[model samples]
Target: MIRKLYDVIVVGAGSMGMSAGYELARRGFKTLLIDAFDPPHPLGSHHGEPRLIRHAYGGGAAYVKMALRADKRWLELEEATGEKLLERSGVLNIADPDVYSYEGRFEDAAVHGVSIESLDAQQIHERWSGVRLPDHFRAMYEPNAGYLYSEKCVAAYKKVALQAGATLLTHTFVTNIKPEKSYVTVSTKDDEFMAAKVILSAGAWFKTLEPFVHLPIRAVRKVVGWFEPSGKSFDAGAFPGFTFGNASGGYYGFPSIGGAGVKIGRHDTGVEWRPGEELEPFGTYPEDEDDLRRVLESFLPGAAGKLLRSAVCKYEFTPDDNFIIDTHPEFSSVLLAGGFSGHGFKFSSVVGEMLADQVELGKWGQDVGLFSARRFAQEDN
Candidate 1:
């Protein structure tokens, strides 16, 4: 059988994979990106129209640099493609005043020089009349951080990657991967292709792929809902993207952009998903709408009129929610970039650059030790 060859083969042309292909193609590498479905499709995490981009990362202080870099790249892409990709609506985080609900977020902002404003509940309610929080809850507002038009961002990357000489095979599923001494072979049932290097970024289906079977990641199903607002107070132009959290749990949301209604979703609620199975629709479970309704009724009662629309997606989570963007332990030529958990779509641009740097220079420009897969190995000892 004949084998087609390229400099890099990126499996899973969704958010990270597509961006990596774009970066590699721009660097004059012969790249091929193969995906099971057309990207920016409704099946993945990047499907939702908008994704919040916060520089004062709640996850850890180490992420602020990557988040800032990703923000810059998003703006650069918007300028280059002339696409309306980022919505600068700002982001407001509501939590208890005394308790640091968002771990390391304040420290991250301080270390990165990212500006943020602290507001008490009364001040928050006064500024955004639609929001009603308990007096004990305080807020940290990042005026410069906002939400991205996620689907549009993926579409733009796909377009420019092709323009930069990258080849993409959409609706083509990779059945197996075999790493060799000099090259890696990717099989798609009917054909085989070889590349000098490969990026295994299969997202939610990461565990189902070979050479990654025991990668200690799980695919989980998640849902988000859009509700009709009672008035124009919830309009995207006037309202900001927001997060509400405490000792109980956390919920994140976006304002009604383009009359799409106020979109909301719980951050930590996810049901384990079996790979290769069709995703259950949004309303399959009662909590899908009920959980979101509970949040809206408690905080933004004005925006919880009726359920306008809903969608389901997947999240690939590691034991710890941090991402894993390192080389495969056994294969130097195969890079692994998955286990984003959640809160990763915002960093897709910078992550792609990091993976590209790893491919060409064999090292990342930034210290990504926090995301290394070896952390799990170390924990087991």
Candidate 2:
């Protein structure tokens, strides 16, 4: 059968792919977005209700610019869609001073002129009565940092992309990708499609495309839990989204939103997940609940009331947890973006724009050298 031709084909129409599809379609490209399941589905990464967005990035100073840019684009999307996507309830990064250093974060904030407030453990407890921090822990609060409604963000992107004439194929699984000299062809279970440029934003399923783009990405299963808070202190009005760092890793949580209770998760604990394997049902991992309970008991004891519910998600990690956004080394027509590590959902807005720019202009506006796939190649040397 003759395949349909599009200007750009976006695989995995989740957070990053949907945004890129919107940008490409808005630019008048005949864009086609394909996904195994409908987006906003629990099977993918961007499913859980809220994801934190912060300007004072814990990842590194180099990411501050992208984070800020993503924040701006999110606002633009909100205005365009007329949907409340971002909630500026602020964010707190607390860490034991000896284990986690905030010096680089402070320098990044100062250099970028982003607003950040430093607070001691006493100050933190005084400001939010529900929190119990030891004297040795330090905190940095970014008033602009907050949470984004994950499902709503994806829906808004999809709405805008559909309005802009992007074709979406839900429940369609991609079987293979073939990159030619000037164009790329994508094979789905039902049919084949060709595009001038193809983007593989396949999230946890990225390993399926490993032969085309050899990036060391591993899919790991992680869990998040919602708990009933004892008092109103954990509400959005009083408490902010927070992260607590330690020698092992960190635990992050969001205030109770829409009566969903305080949602918490550990950033460091995830087991390697093989693709095509059955994913465990939600609330099946009792150990995850125990770990989260331990974190809440240590930091915000009042927030750990009852184990309301839990869900599992996947994070694709690179050797270095930074994202991989670059053209294929051999086939320029094929672009790849994955390895978001666990903190990529917030930047989906800007990442989409960058992917679209890569396809349309042959370059992106921002200095994306930090996320370049070539870095891994250089590291191998």
Candidate 3:
């Protein structure tokens, strides 16, 4: 059956889409949040026990402003849900002096006035003596940056969205979107949706949406895993979460949230991937296990006491690895929040607000001019 009309239709109701739906519904709009699965599922990207929520964007300083506002919204959601979604235990970034992570993040802190502390290798060893660190490694500590219960956070938004009169259709895979001058026609296997506006937050499926809107997003499959740290001192407190970058590789992870282990994964392990193909096969990869073992062997052997669990998630990567949150080229009715590149979870809250404005006011107040689809047409990535 075809739905008669909707103010907004959000595809892929995981973190960002659900939050947007919740916001729209709260604003007295008839919103629909559709998903391929019920969510909090293994097939899609927004899983795992927890995710690191760091401020002081290593990506750039412009993101810092957005992140600060987003951080506030996360706190607001936490208050609404009455669930502790974020942990302010802090984030430790370990890298060399010349590396992008250390120096850039340091600059971000200075530029944005975000609280940060730069530490020497000895200082890092002193502050957290539980794990091993290289002698030449420098560290930047952002006290506001910590971890978030990502799946639970999404679930909270979904619950509130339903409460606000938003309709959520689970197991509805959106196959096509055709835009008319008036509205967009969205189709799924079981039903069709007609909405005044549409938002494409379909995560890894961003590439497939290019025909609908020319988004220069490449979906890449990346691995995240938890390790059973043998030493009790290797616990969460003893092991403040971190994002690392070096000439060899960069990675990030949470402390022992599962109570039995420390979780970690390499950021750049994904060579290019095609969706539904290598994005996420039916199960884990043997080479994935070998890769985690290799990383642990190179970095923290104690935390890698056991590969307790492992899985893969796809990151919708833009050429510049930044997000695209703006209207489509030819259609004002279709909005997009694509190419998160493994870092959009933290900004989901404020991103929803921006998208809501795009649907209602015809433009967002924020300076997302950098996220335009036209950027791809230029030479720079």
In model 2, which runs have C-alpha deviations exceeding 4 angstroms?
none
What ordering of candidates by lDDT runs from best to worst?
2, 1, 3
Clashing residue pairs in candidate 3 (N, C-alpha, C atoms within 3 angstroms): none
Clashing pairs in 2: none
Candidate 3, 1-381: lDDT as tens digits: 856689889998888899999999999999999887897676666887677777777667668888888889989989988999988879988876676646677787787789999887888877776546678777888887888888898899998999999999888778889999898999877778899899988887765655777677777777877778776656766678887777767778777875757777777757567655745541356766666666666666777776677777777778888788878778878888878888888888988989997777777757796677778877654
Give each model a TM-score. 0.97, 0.97, 0.93
lDDT of 1 by residue, 1-381 (tens): 678999999999999999999999999999999998999898778998789998998666668889999999999999989998888899999986565565468777988899899888899999999998888898899999899988999999999999999999988888888988899999997889999999988898776685544577888899999999988999998999998887657889999988999999888868998777889998888998999998899889999988998989888888899999888887888898999987899999999999999999989887788899788888999
The TM-score measured for candidate 2 stands at 0.97
Model 2 RMSD in angstroms: 1.2
Rank the models by TM-score, top first. 2, 1, 3
How do the residues 80-118 of candidate 2 rate in per-residue lDDT, one tens digit apiece?
A: 999999999999999998998888889889999899999
Consecutive 10-residue window with the lowest summed lDDT within model 2 = 279-288
Could you tell me the TM-score of candidate 1? 0.97
lDDT of 3 at 225: 74
Winner by lDDT between candidate 3 and candidate 2: 2
